[model samples]
Target: MNVHFKYEKNIQIEHLETLYNDVQWYAYTQDLAVLQTAITQSLDVLTAWDGEELVGLVRVVGDGLTILYIQDILILNAYQNQGIATQLMQQILEKYHHIRQKVLLTEEAADVRHFYEKNGFTSCDQGSLVAFAQVR
Candidate 1:
């Protein structure tokens, strides 16, 4: 498993579809065009590739100065528990260390909470902060 990371946004639709679907994130796979546009327009994108196969991704959206929102971070099911996601998180954090307001929203799950907590993130309720989202 010689996985390497890249900060490239010009990814192919097939690769995006395969990786998103592999992680069971069907919503993004539903619209390949929109997904591609989203990636290209992101503040930053870090992708893990095994040879030519994209196995992991972490993307951010923000002005790159004051706030950063982790729009998505995922790894293929077969590639989980290998620290790829953590590395992705680390790289992004290091890149935006100066940003004061880093945020992300994910489904409520034990593992999800643990992962974010392990990555030095605290839940909204844990602090004096509350988050709201409008999903469709």
Candidate 2:
């Protein structure tokens, strides 16, 4: 696929819109400006591209020491199951391996759970950890 990864904060909004839309992340795509700001303000951002096409992205917000939260990880539908997501996660994981706590919240789909589990993430409720959230 000639894919390459780049750690960039100022990614093109149009490219991100296309990538997010390709993955059905309608809510984010609904506001291009907000999405662009979110990307620019994240603690870290990783993008995967196939030549000129944006195919995957990983967004993280962390203190760089004590905690790291994986805010988003997505791969375009056309590029799913191609190890792109894994590579993106691996890069992020390696970068913050020393962080005391890593966390994320995601939809309760088996595939989603399995994807995180396979990447060495255990569910909070599955263990002694508990999580609470109030989404607006």
Candidate 3:
């Protein structure tokens, strides 16, 4: 399959919602607010398209120069197993290659861990640290 990859910094918010809903791992309907915040404040976002359809996406949110938190690496179910996620991560990594400060929270899924590890991320030592936030 010739999957064409179209890269963009600011993708339509609606397209992102659609892609989020299409992915199996995320709770789409319940995550709209979180997703919106990510889109609106993201330091960078990359969307993958097979022609006019969005197949995969990933975003990084943080201070543009120093710290970056990778958020929402998602690909539609039908598009899984293809190299789309890998390609998306590769592109994001390239964009941040010169920057040394970056981190991402990943689900504990074994495959997901493998993917991140393949991309050069290692498990962090924040074992006793806790993250908290109040949702509006």
Candidate 4:
């Protein structure tokens, strides 16, 4: 798998919907306009592609100096468990290594928890940190 990475803002909307929907993250896939705008407006957007296929992406939003929120990190189902997600995240973390707070919220699946934990992210309960979110 020859994957190319880029920190650019010109990915096609159709590609995003394909990747997002592949993992069942319909909240964003349901609205391409919102998703495209969100991604284009992020502080940083890292994408992974195999030739012409959009296989993975990492989107972040925050002040470059203090806080960084990982809004999304996704890899197509066929690409999961292949270290693509880890590489995407490592790129983002390296770019913002000096930031004090790096955060993200994900579902409570065991694999999700395990993935984040392995990447050095602590759960709110584990780190004594409180996280709050509302589903609209």
Full-model lDDT for every candidate: 0.96, 0.93, 0.75, 0.91
* Candidate whose TM-score is highest: 1
Question: When superposed on Cα atoms, how far off is each prediction in RMSD?
Answer: 0.6, 0.8, 3.4, 1.0
Q: Count the backbone clashes (under 3 Å) in each candidate.
A: 0, 0, 0, 0
lDDT of 4 by residue, 33-110 (tens): 999999989999999999999999999999889999998999999988999999999889998999988999888999
Worst 10 residues of 1 by lDDT: 22-31
lDDT of 3: 0.75
TM-score of each: 0.98, 0.97, 0.78, 0.95
Q: Which scores higher on TM-score, 2 or 4?
A: 2
The TM-score, computed over Cα atoms with residue i paired to residue i, of candidate 3 is 0.78
Query: For model 3, how does the per-residue alpha-carbon lDDT over 32-133 read when each residue is reduced to its tens digit?
Result: 776676576778778778777777878788776777788778888888988888998898888878777778876678898889889888766435545554
Against the true structure, candidate 2 reaches a TM-score of 0.97
- Alpha-carbon error at 79 in model 1, in Å? 0.6
Full candidate order by TM-score, most accurate first: 1, 2, 4, 3
- What is residue 65's positional error in candidate 4, in angstroms? 1.2
Model 2: lowest-lDDT 10 consecutive positions: 16-25
Q: By descending lDDT, how would the candidates be arranged?
A: 1, 2, 4, 3
Whole-model lDDT, candidate 1? Answer: 0.96
